[model samples]
Target chain A: MSIDTDDPTVAAAPDPEPDNSLGGIFRAYLAKLRGGEVGSLPAVLGLIALVVVFSSLRPEQFTNSFNFANLIGQSAGVTVLAMGLVFVLLLGEIDLSAGFAGGTCAGVLGVFLTRQEWPLIPALLAALLTGALIGLLIGLLVARLGIPSFVVTLAAFLGLQGVLLTMIGEGGTIPIRNDFINGLNNANLPVWLGWALGLLCIVGYAASTYITDARRRAKNLTVQPLLLWALKTGLLTVVVVAVVGYLSVERSRNPALTSLKGVPVSLVVIVGLLILLTFTLTRTAWGRHVYAVGGNAEAARRAGINVFRVRLSCFILCSTMAAVAGIMIASRTNSVNPNTGGETTLLYAVGAAVIGGTSLFGGKGRVIDAVIGGTVVAVIDNGMGLLDQPQGTVWMVTGLVLLVAASVDALSRRRASATGHV
Target chain B: MSPLLELHGVEKSFGAVQVLRGVDLSVQAGRVTALVGDNGAGKSTLVKGMAGIHLFDAGDYLFEGEPVKVTNPKDAAALGIEVVYQDLALCDNLDVVHNMFLGREMKRLRLVDEDTMEQRARETLDGLSVRTLKSVRTPVASLSGGQRQTVAIARAVLWNSKLVILDEPTAALGVAQTEQVLRLVRRLADRGLGVLLISHNLNDVFEVADDIAVLYLGGMVGQIDAASTTRERVVQAITTGVVPEGGAA
Candidate 1:
């Protein structure tokens, strides 16, 4: 791959490849993983180990379909909130106020819906707008005033908790009566609908991959072998279909409860969000700019990127996603209170992002890291509770897992840099 | 031919300390002009003025014989002038294509057209005969110093720059990498783009520069055709601000 001539156009093309077969691809992937391309591997492995250990300890409680569904529902709020934090974390910034900001947004929605008796859309809109404005204020302080994000968000954390307290008032809770909001956690899709949704996702993913591959081939670029693509798609399909089938099984012993066995609406919401956000963070130019800014703000500025604008947008997006998480939390509990979104909620969100593989050092992460990390946390919580462990035990296990995840991240990053693969 | 960029009596100061004082310099298309100076001789300040990072307080800044006021980097960029800073100004976390088209991405249907951008990046690198890179998708951090320098130069060239300024292009590079970069600079000039190279290494300055401009004590000492002068004369000019046999300033 050396250019020997002064005239580059006259240089001969380099050797192509030893193999373009399935075995070659597999070996390459193995080598890559060894070379520190271990994105989400630790989380996935942790998830498997949790399943094995928990099933051995409490098969009836942990392996039940109902409990699995509950785990997904429990993870929804943290997962969504963590998704927002992914953006901030990508820039190596922290939002200590994520939970409180979300709590305040939910409080706004609750007050408008119950006290003022407002329409649902307007109430939700007002909550989202309030979240955006909060983010804008924090972003302005960070970007315009040049305060470090950690300080600005820490102040917001305290201030927004106060806002939540005032909204709910002393020793009070607003019980949400809205059918749609409350049903977000309580309801489930029909079995057929759940299967159809899973099918849709699989088909959509495969189609996009095929189109990309075709485009690459047409351009005379290196394309992954069709067999390898099929293997990947087949593996994904099996996992998705298996999850759907498992969820579709009837969980209730009572003969009256016939339709409550499918995927929870909350799971669907989180998945939908996961898809939307993954697209935004991967396919869009805005997403690229976010990474660039997070990677090197000075370099980004030199490239003429409006660093202020990028940082502000990240804050706005994070707060807006946090607002959505707040709505989900309120929906699940049917109430908004002073205690909502406090007491380890923000810690879980940040932990979820970090444990899922998003770097605290910025510029290296994906939106899906939140999902993996959130699921891991939820499984630990669910499994520990099934083993008759106390909340403190669960906390310790979660903390240990978070520490392991961080060590994995740090080690992998160092290896990557050392190997010059970066 | 007339110089592509001409700076006449450019002056700048930070507070009371003047960094550039009435510096006159010109860069011709299809030629490499090396700007040599000592540590405090204001080479950086002069280059910054041309880059539009620090607008000259007093000067006739001309582009193609037309006087213009360049107050910012954007103004310089608008006139097809690109500066590859010594630090390279590359986000190490980003891949080569992203770094090449960082802020000004070629979008199709409002989305970053990665395919098109990748194609253009490949063409740009190929045009400059840079064949050492394994892939355009490789992150900047993985590249060797010489490859990184090439990426920086390729980025400057990709933007259709008429005058490309490189500051200390070979300072941190190994001997082989330095040779590769000097050749690339020669190729850039061969492509008819005006090149301003800033360096402390006179050996490099002599190897590739067509004309050499010496800066001493925040002022231009002389601008001499490189082949007509020797390293001792250039060193004397850089250190003493005078050519032994009366070179033109």
Candidate 2:
């Protein structure tokens, strides 16, 4: 009988078995890309292309171990901010105040540390708490009072800038001298410890992949071919080994005076957050509810989900992450000022997310997308600096890139709908 | 046998307009009772009352011969009452399995239990004899209209629901899809559940409904066996707000 038959009896028969071979999986992935589910393919390709072009043009500066580490440090703050924005974007909501919110949180931290003389941990908590309160107010205005998120966050954006300025006394800046706080961006893991962490990441990934597939097999659900899994694991192994190996080489300007080798702690922080957020989005029920609400709020409500709570939590998560990003920025600058988390910070974070393939329309994104896209942004900024390009040129290029990414998002969304995959 | 659900003197009004005026209706287990009416005949208002979207102004809402209060949607759900709205309400971005268990996800160790949910969704679709769908994992956005209706029906029955109220299941479907949905409705009743189908199509009512309940203006005119009455008589009752001469009331 034809599989297309509408006969209930024939239809009730077991579905045609899916092809689980590596070739079959590859073909399916290609089909998905054509259907406008590109995920992070474009961002990854763009990152590689930029790296190649920069290395060819200014190989001495762009490809050095010191610059590589610097790129990671530079991207960490924006990557963390983008990671939080992904949560808001997944709900089809925009948090325009996220940059200034970060600034305000950093100002809070600066005050608690320098003025109150509180220890590091308590000051960090106060900063995070400030972020949460700002988020809660915005969430209430948008989710509960039914104000458009764009307007609410835009208002917060202007208001939070004032809050930050007042906290930092307009023209004043607070210098951070604490060793541990400063070390977040300046310190590096020992070479042995960096190697151990890299291996641990690979092993954890492999174990999770194997265990999930095994469980699916036990339940008689379709699982990807073993070869495909091995290919992915092997690819990750190569990348990890290459990165750790490159960073292990000493890049100290004067070897007799100092030793600078090993992965930056900022990189570690980003990776840890990536793993945690990715797990929350993929493995937990709350994450599933977030996707559902983003996809269709009315349907989610009809299904008995608390639409308001889901929205509120997302705003909270976004701001909390922004606070963490604020900390990273302050650490990198060695001080907190009114401008710490302002001036293209929010723009780059948003660009990073969209360029990485997260739909601004909601219900489609991943935490890893932010990291890949953040790398792209950092590369563009770093490469231009190496070439001695004007600041105006840099802003125009970044704006043009963001415009292109958003256009791609809109066009892909149309294609997805036309192809019945939306 | 006592009816699965029985409403006595149910009256509902909105502001200055009366929508349901002391209406009485009953639905039997192992049978399909089609509620037929014109646009302003209080059909939706009555169904809303039953689903607890709107509380009746005054009424004795009885289920299984016992008076029960259905003040909200949750209350109706507690009584195993499920409504498949005309819009379907399935999230386009989610696959059929996810849509089926949207808010009520099965969880293990604080994580969504995908394995158990997939298995149960597969079994539920199979039990309903649904064949048009190739895979339950397919996103709802990609499914045909008939396939979406099938998923919605399956979701309604998945909860051990005793009463399934369908609001215009075939309203937006083509001929073949309408046939598929009518057959599914027949199967639900055949499985010994009370199926309350609300529709404007006479052909659909004649095809699958075992009993016909006609509403006119704001009152239920008559509830009669489909086999004993003609379509013309039902139409007369719907328009005139009165059972026809020599028609069983």
Candidate 3:
């Protein structure tokens, strides 16, 4: 496997393979490809280990299909919000205002649709645009005014909180009146339709891989072994299908009580976003530029890249995503209130991002990591609730898991650095 | 014919510290020029001025014998002058193609054209005979020093640069990697591009360069033919700031 040449740190590690045996050599090659090529395998596995530990603690509830669906629905907002956070974080900036952005946007959208009796389309656009503008203003302050993003965004966080409180008014609650928009929280495609969609997505992914590899191989180029490539794609397919089935089962079971269970429309939007972002970052040039700027701004600038444009773009993306998550939360509650977003939601979003394997230092991360990390958080939350643990215990447990994930990322980065993997 | 790039009586400073003092350098087409100097001898300052990162205090920069005042690095790039900094400015998380086209990616409808980018990246690397690399998709963090240097040079050439400035490409490379890089430098000059290579390693300078320029304490000491120069004399010029034949500063 060809190693990444940009990071001298990870590239400096001594070659660990010299054996010629077929089995041993192949395993070592896999490790090199999987471990060093795309971030870290340790962090990914650590996330799983955390999930396993939580499941073992409350096997009857955590491992159950109903609870697994609950986890997905519960984590959907945080996951989407964290995805946007990853963009800003990878640029080595903090958007502490993410929670507040979501809260204010959600409240604003509710007011537009319910109080003003506006249509859903205009209300949604206004909410998202407001969030984007907030981020744009913050970007301008940091990029042009020479203020640090941390300070600029922090001030925004506090200011947005006050705005949200005022918007909620002294009563502190406003119910959404629009039918089509409010039903987004309760809506779901049929279970079989979900399965079909899952299959279609998996098939599309496999086809894209086959076509790209075939074209490359026809030119006598270096293509990854079919077996290795298939192994990863197959795993992705299985995980996706299983998640759909679990959500479907939960939806079917809830019909016995309130007939109110299914894959929420917000969840679908979140998945669609994941696919869009993954394609943008991995398969596009702007994604490459973003990674370049994050990796080394000076180097990127010298290469004739517009460093300012890429950074500003990241902030815009991040705030727009937070707005979407805020809309989802508001839809789920069917109400906007002062307490819509708080310290708990903000901490969870940040934790989910770190757990997803985005580097605290920037220039390394995946959108998929956010999804997995969000799931891990939901697993812990849903399982602890089943065990009847106090809210404090839930917070402590999540904090510990977040700490471990962060430690894994830090150690791997040092390893990558020491080995000249830069 | 006149030199491809000419720096006539250039003077530059940073803050209150004077760095380049009326330095004049001429790089002819189809030849390798080596820059040698002591640690604080203003080599970086002179190069930075030419690269447009630092505007000269007083100088006339001529391209094709016409005086041109460059405002920034962007102008230099548009004029086909590419400078590969000592640090190389590569992002490890990105693949070779991504690294090569970091800021200027080919996109259609706001999406990167991966297939075409990969095709071109492969062609550039292959043309250079960079055999050490296994795949264009491999992250740069995994390449050996020699391979990483190859990627940087390829990127400069791919952008259709006329003059290439490499800052100490072999300083931290191993023996094999150094040999690989020196070979690439020789090939670049053979392609008729003007190459200004900065190196402390006399061995590398002697092996690849056709002409050598020496600097001492923010001033040009002398420019001599590489074939007629010796490592000992070069070291002496660097340390004692005396060329012995009269042109010291």
Candidate 4:
């Protein structure tokens, strides 16, 4: 028969029946890890190296409990901004104006809070709405009018800077008086509340991961081994508990205000955003659609996805995240000024995302990239500050790290394309 | 068997250009109807018309003998008509499971049900007797041309479609890969789909097609049974749009 069942090419080699057992899964994972399919490993390793080097060089300063807490605390603004950038970057797009657009959002809120004397909730909403409106305009221009995102956002970058300047006025500063808003970065959760929150996170993570893995196994689908899953869950539990434990230790030298020391408010906010975004990007059909659109727009369209809507939603999300990051920045500094969320802010956000291993060409990235990438940038800045490095030295070193990251991205992409593997 | 899909006297135009004129075509259930033509012979236009990318200006589109109107791809999809374009329509960055269930993802609790979707994707590939893939989790970009084509075909059938129109399925494949895909085409028909196989490869057409329809300059020469026709006559119709008076098409 021309259609022979034994045609070698037609049937190909039966892939070694997948070893679905724990040992087999472990072996497979090891293989992938060796192949550099282990996402975020590089960033984590870099972060660890930075922590060790900095602590050894300036143990008294870098290893201080206050510094450790402050490192995470100060990362909130750029971390959130980078999280937003990850969305756009995954779509193989860029938001050049994200930093200043965030600034504009903060300025709007600051003006309302300090100058217009608006209520906090209403002011907050207006500020967020302004961010969304800017994003909507950018989305329409990019998705509907077919303008390249680079051009549109570059225009936004300059235009939003102007808007921020106008709102705060030239060489002016607007001090945020709302205690609730101002406390966002500086406040710490009560020690008991911090432990409770950590426990909640561990439980939630364990339950969701276990339920989903169990469901997949029940359906006889490919699943990670139980041992591996348990190992991962255990590691997460340890990390969260340790973080809460560390944060709960009093860093205050002041005898009276020592009770105020606990997990910084920004840590909770950052973690919350991380979980929310990770779920959205991984577990939702809309997230899959965004990936498909980024991978191949025509294929997505042929598959009956509304490509325009996906693109628009992605831009809106990027902008909305920037708005949140802006608010965090305002909270941290207790004021909004012309220089807030300027060039370095956007630069660092993009750097953090890319350095943390988010692909510049989209369709492949994770929210966790921002978390890791943000830490790397913050540590570098923090380390240099302790060393009393000149401003030029800090810029030069950050630029170098970003270039290396870009090179890694380009190199890995080339290798992947050459090997025809993800 | 009656034709599952029939287009009667279909006409299409682009400004002053008439791309398809009074073309009549029919495809039966559980059969492969080969659509062949020279370059610029309106083969794509005819397929696009049926795919709902471009609607025929003047035609009666009949499904199971009932006239229907398909204004867009979504409408055609709703009617169980799927077209696998020449590009294969698979996202390179997505894994096989993801690509298989791109837009129509299975959901549980308003979230994508990855387990069910993966199982279904595996089952669909198994049903097609495709064993080349090491895992369904492999990205489409990592797949060979033939495997990608298989993925596209599997995706079309995964939706439980009644009719599948393939445009140049083997055009970019190698000799071995082409044979693999041709075998896959037969398997799809064996599964009882109404298959419209558009191709330029005469050997491929002869190997799998149950019926042959040749197009010449915006007009269909005729639809003839593949088993009863010779290559020379089919070529003659393709090149000149006319079979010798004594020869059967």
Candidate 5:
């Protein structure tokens, strides 16, 4: 009954508790995988496999720095959209209208910026406001009116597409001539600045980890071994170094004319968002309420959480992120058309989330999961194009990849339940 | 000494059906009061009324000899009354510490204070002499039925509650687990907290209860002393809504 006093005899005796050393942590991780808490393992392994396969098939083209940078720009929109979807899916809800919702917001941006001749910031704000308003309406219907989210968002999907078409006129496109907006996807940081930022990321990650471990240790709580922490930091360091190194090299077709070097601005934006969203989801009380509601709405309500407010907020954040994604896509293409966020865009975003190991069934996901899954989606599309494959082939392969990811999610969920870890 | 909680002539009805009719109950501190009855005996309705989930149509609800109004769950909570329902409301995805401090998490700088929460949770569990849990960080999904019940009970008393009400806490547990939970329930009373335990199991009622309050047809049969009453007499009261002549009341 007394937890404070340590018995000298017991202290002298062999410790019988489970090990908390580095090796023990590794074993525990393996056991978790076996128990079907596979998490991001499958996605990481698949990404590696795809990179190896594509590099072997198109040795010169796929391994080049130019294509590496292209991949980041291509994945930016889907990654941003998937990040939003992660929040919605965490509540066992879907936002089918997110894609067209993005398009509609982009159309608003086009009308404000190109037609009305407004400045960048105001037009951007107007676009984001449009996104928030759409989310508010959808959230109202889903949370307050008690309509099924699937039905509400599905209706919104069709309605938003029509709204976009009407704003831009049927088959019309608005060319974006704004340099700052275009620079989002096409520009790069200076090589020196890129290195500085990359190093800063590594330092920041290490500092945060050290501070958390120190606090936990100060409280006499169970803390992972220092070796495990070092290993994780080392891994992140390697990744950032590799990406920054690759991007720092001159990848321009004509190095004498223009230097296409340093990390893409879109990549920096995405990483910033990833850090912010990850912090929000892991550290904040509102984030915990989200997971609680996702896990068991009844339990959350009984615990005095406003389940409806959590539901409404998630939808609002999802659509706002979608609006950001729409802006990025428009930046990449230098224009806003009815098709800006139409066709395979929403599917790719959802697929990215699922493929990154975010569960379709609520209560399991992270912001980083969407980023990893988005990269996997981008690689498939990029690789298929390099292979000179038909558009049909690319879509089929992407579809099959999504299907397999979903099957893995379902099977792992079943395994988790069987092992009493559900 | 006055009872920690006393309900006098409590009446409740839903539409045309009157679920409870002039029921009386008293729970004393440092004692276990077992409320027993058969199906549709209005045990749940009575407890819900006291919990403010359903306000009694008419009654004198007194706490520490003071008349109080409990119109909602928040009011009941403010009065230091906590209810652990039969279903044991807990989020499986959250760990024991998180579940214990679910909606009422301690925050520092607008972020959940994880270190403080973990420390408090460990201290609370230790104070209850809970040694079955190896770590407070284990997810509720991975815990056994008995452990989950323990967590629920621990959560009920976390807020320095004056009275704790549990509905069928052992109904879904095994014999060994049932014994574990009953011992914990008794330990709660030993800590000078009033405990109102609603159960159908006679063995449980007789094992830890100091007072036995029988409900029949939405009416109180009698609140009898457990040590002086026979099981047959209590059973008779439940079945016929009348106390036997020789029964201690």
Candidate 6:
């Protein structure tokens, strides 16, 4: 109403002269829908391009369904731990101990279940508790002592490494013989179950997003355009379909052994954890406080948010998730030993998170970003492995990708602040 | 009338720089008390001390005509006092409703009660006459400066706030938005809130303030009714320690 008369400048020249061309308007809408996604477009496309390059380079091996399954199975533990690492990263903190912490948990679980004859469920709980306790210790040192997270966690990493070494007993190993634990690593869900689950998850996620968007829109919310929403749901559907399709086929060819089954249990567990973490981060008061602490500690403090508790909880969650990853890794390999923690695995987890576009400067990341980032890291590792790249080369390339992602995060942060968009 | 909040001989020093030197302030219910001073005139210090952000080194704070202690922000909040600092601390990623209930949320069955919070937040914002909000769910990042200020003010008010201290509330808003917020301030006073408005914008001060207490270099220069005092006199007291041509504390 005011546009017609109150602003003389807007009224003076206003004959609507095809203000937005169809193509321009369409393109603008595309750009808008791609809001934060724009910063990560390069990496997303890179994942695709890498797949193409790897498949062509080793068409016989890389393009095989078996190899693809192998890649997913192999990276499962890393990705799980990476997801947890993302939470710590979100607070602009580092958890150097996640790798060994998880490994220590594996040893703890191995001792409890395989040797002590504890049930797999209780044993796993004990392992998770162990991880959470480690995280709590780290959190206590950092929050109460006011020591930096990096320094504190670094010490925790070294200390946990020693503790793991001690637990496993001088390069000794625990052979996990539990049928249930082995089934989680070796077996898969039925193809129909996988497809049904995949479709259900995709539909559920999309519907939830749409419903939330509509609910907000009813409140006259400023929603991203419908096209953007469509694009997201569409892309999500494609990814789920592709993954389920790939997982449905037989990837094994041994006469005695079973043919490939379904998505690994770890993958299912990862998804469940992602959903839970996402809810905790986005929907809960505690999650909001984490963002608050990250965004402005002083401000959050003034708002009466218990900043220390938020930070401590993030660390606690990170390590607890790490413990879950450890349980998976121990089950997959059937042992906990000197190499249980794995070398540079924790660094890779951080690399995955940093590559996924989480800000090192904090207060500006999503759990989904970490999930996306974990997949990105997995894609690179898988692609490089298909090319028969050396372990050194894999680490080097991962480091480069991490650097690029960090740069992208920093640049995008600047752009967001400048445009006042974030 | 007796003061509802009193700061007697408050002093703040950072190293060798003493920002507030034996500053005295008195605030009462249902009135807008303006803290007027030049830049670096210890106005912020006095405000912080009053809001519990800073503890005065040598001051006795009297609340409701009795001496009280405020160790931190939580203590101040528990007493129904709120300070809207200059930066506001409004989360850019949060919406109006979320920002209003950021830390202190309505809980039911041990979970954040969405319905109760949303309804209350909507009411608080509506009461402020902030109709231009795009949505209560829109991230505060998209809000105009005035809208963001409205969110901060709403957050402060929604907490059952009694003594609302607004630090430079109209500093960056447009003329009309300033008028809107000033009116909101007036309504708050009418609700029997003790409002301590710290503003350099004398026009804004004159519009909403009931009594303008000038702070000049860590001292209580003078307290004058907005109805009786002229802008020239306030400005003079603000610039110099002495009140304009025959004013006194």
User: What are the per-model DockQ values?
Assistant: 0.48, 0.52, 0.42, 0.51, 0.50, 0.28
- Expressed as tens digits, the lDDT of each residue in B1-249 for candidate 2 is 999999999999899999888899999999999999999999999999999999999989999999999989999999999999999999887889899999999999989998899899988888888867776777776667888899999999999999999999999998888999999999999999999999999999999999999988888898988998899999888888788887765
**TM-score for chain B considered on its own, for each of the candidates:** 0.97, 0.98, 0.94, 0.97, 0.99, 0.93
Candidate 1: stretches off by over 4 Å: A1-15, B246-249
- List where candidate 2 sits over 4 angstroms from the true fold: A5-14
Superposed by TM-score, candidate 5 places the C-alpha of residue B10 at a distance from the truth, in angstroms, of 0.4
Error of 5 at B230 (Å): 2.3
lDDT of each: 0.88, 0.90, 0.79, 0.87, 0.90, 0.77
Worst 10 residues of 6 chain B by lDDT: B130-139
TM-scores, all models, native as reference? 0.96, 0.96, 0.89, 0.95, 0.97, 0.85
True contacts kept of 4: 0.57
Model 1 Cα lDDT, one tens digit per residue, B1-249 = 899999899899999999999999999999999999899999998888888888788989999999988889999999999999999988878889999999998988888888888889989998998877656776776677788899999999998999999999999988888999999999999999999999999989999999999989999887999988888899889888887794553
Prediction-by-prediction clash tally: 0, 1, 32, 0, 0, 0
Worst 10 residues of 5 chain B by lDDT: B134-143
| lDDT for each residue of candidate 6 in B1-249, tens digit (9 for 90 to 100) | 888788887878888888777777788898888888898888888877777778888888888887889988778888888988878898775667778888887777766666567778877876766555534665566556666777888889997888999999989878767777788888888888899999988888888888888877767787887787788888888887777754443
Q: A1-422 in candidate 3: lDDT tens per residue?
A: 35444333332211333344456447656655545333545546765776687678878767776666556667877888889988888888788888888888998898898889888899899999988998898888877787998899889989999999998886679898676666665567677778777888889989988888888768655565566567768897888876776677653445667554445566677788999998888777678777887888887877777888888888888888988888777777778888676567777888888887888788888897788788778777887788899999998988888898888777776665555533
- Tens-digit per-residue lDDT, B1-52, candidate 3: 9988998888887889888887888888889999999898998888888888
The true-versus-predicted C-alpha distance at residue B51 of model 2, in Å, is 1.0
Candidate 3 stretches greater than 4 Å from native? A1-30, A33-60, A250-262, B13-22, B57-59, B65-67, B108-110, B216-221, B232-249
Colliding pairs, model 5: none
Q: CA lDDT of B247 in candidate 6?
A: 44
lDDT tens readout by residue for model 6, A52-125: 88878888887777777666666667778888887787777889989999999999999999789898789989
- Model 5 CA lDDT for position B20: 92
**Maximum-lDDT candidate:** 5
Order the candidates by DockQ, highest first. 2, 4, 5, 1, 3, 6
In model 1, the Cα lDDT at residue A387 comes to 91
C-alpha RMSD values across all candidates: 2.8, 2.3, 4.1, 2.9, 3.1, 5.0
